[model samples]
Target: MRDDVRRLLASYEPARQQPDPPLPPAGVLLLLHDRPGGPHVIFQKRTDRVRDHKGQISFPGGVMDPGDPDVRYTALRETHEEIGVRPDDVDVLGELDQMVTVSNFLVTPFVGWLDRYPYEWRFSSEEVAYLLEVPLSHLRDPRNLVPDRRIINGREYVFQAYRFGDDLIWGATARMLGNFLDLLSALE
Candidate 1:
């Protein structure tokens, strides 16, 4: 499975990101299940009680813990700690390129596979209020992802928007997801 995913991503064009100055922190992307039609990625809505990225839909991860040996460890550990998904249940396919968040964190996205749908999630109430599943196929639709334009000092730029059900998954997570979808589309 890892070999197949590697081949898929390898055959596709990679995402283009600018060289970052310095990293503020790190993050994770937990790619859970891939059924017949397409895969599914998990998202957690950060509760307002959290100090950072509160009330936003994000992956089940946070800043690298001091005891973490690396970002990979941080991802798995945080996923388990935040959402009760054990690292043992995850088969890490590989990693997407590191992405720099607007908040200045250097987010390293780890791609992995989750075996089954029937499992339990223990949410960190202070951090996660709820969990949601996004069909990977949804991200492939260009129309589904709208662009928001902004101009500062007579310069213009655009950010991608992902409308999923009633939830708007945007910001760094959307960018990462967009990049991942672009890769999958290229494979197709």
Candidate 2:
């Protein structure tokens, strides 16, 4: 499966979009680790102290800094800052298509692989509330895809999301996850 992921990513051409006026660039790491049952993906529950996406479940990442060389670097840097995984520690598989967030940021999702489990994780309490290590099998189950409805300014919005216990993965993150899962499904 790991080899399949690497090969698939190597040949994949991610779709790109250039919106008018341009949105600020952000990067996120879809960190995957090999676990007992199967593979597990890492997600961080954001603290309410953060400015954007507060109390939301997301991959470890943030906006690109001026000094960062590239979007990939931004993802790695943010991952290291949010969690303790160093850039060198991750075997970066590749990237998925760019996603535009409701917060007006162009986010690039980079997939990375870790060799083992029970990794020494040091997370930022100021930004991260907790970490969730979700198994791929659970995520792949169609039953987990739950419909979410919200009302904003007298308008009803329906969204497709994944439900893991008390957490709801939706919006751009869910879209990105859906894309990643589609690729994995293609391999099977």
Task: Name the candidate that leads on TM-score.
Answer: 2
Off by over 4 Å in 1: 1-3, 9-21, 35-37, 149-157
Model 1 pairs in collision: none
Compared with the true structure, what per-residue lDDT tens digits does model 2 show for residues 17-127?
797889999999999999889899999999999999999999999899999999999999999999889898899999999988889999999999986677999999999
Give the TM-scores of the predictions, in the order they appear. 0.84, 0.97
Residue-level error in angstroms, candidate 1, position 22: 3.4
| Root-mean-square deviation per candidate | 3.0, 1.0
Q: How many backbone clashes does candidate 1 have?
A: 0
Best by lDDT: 2
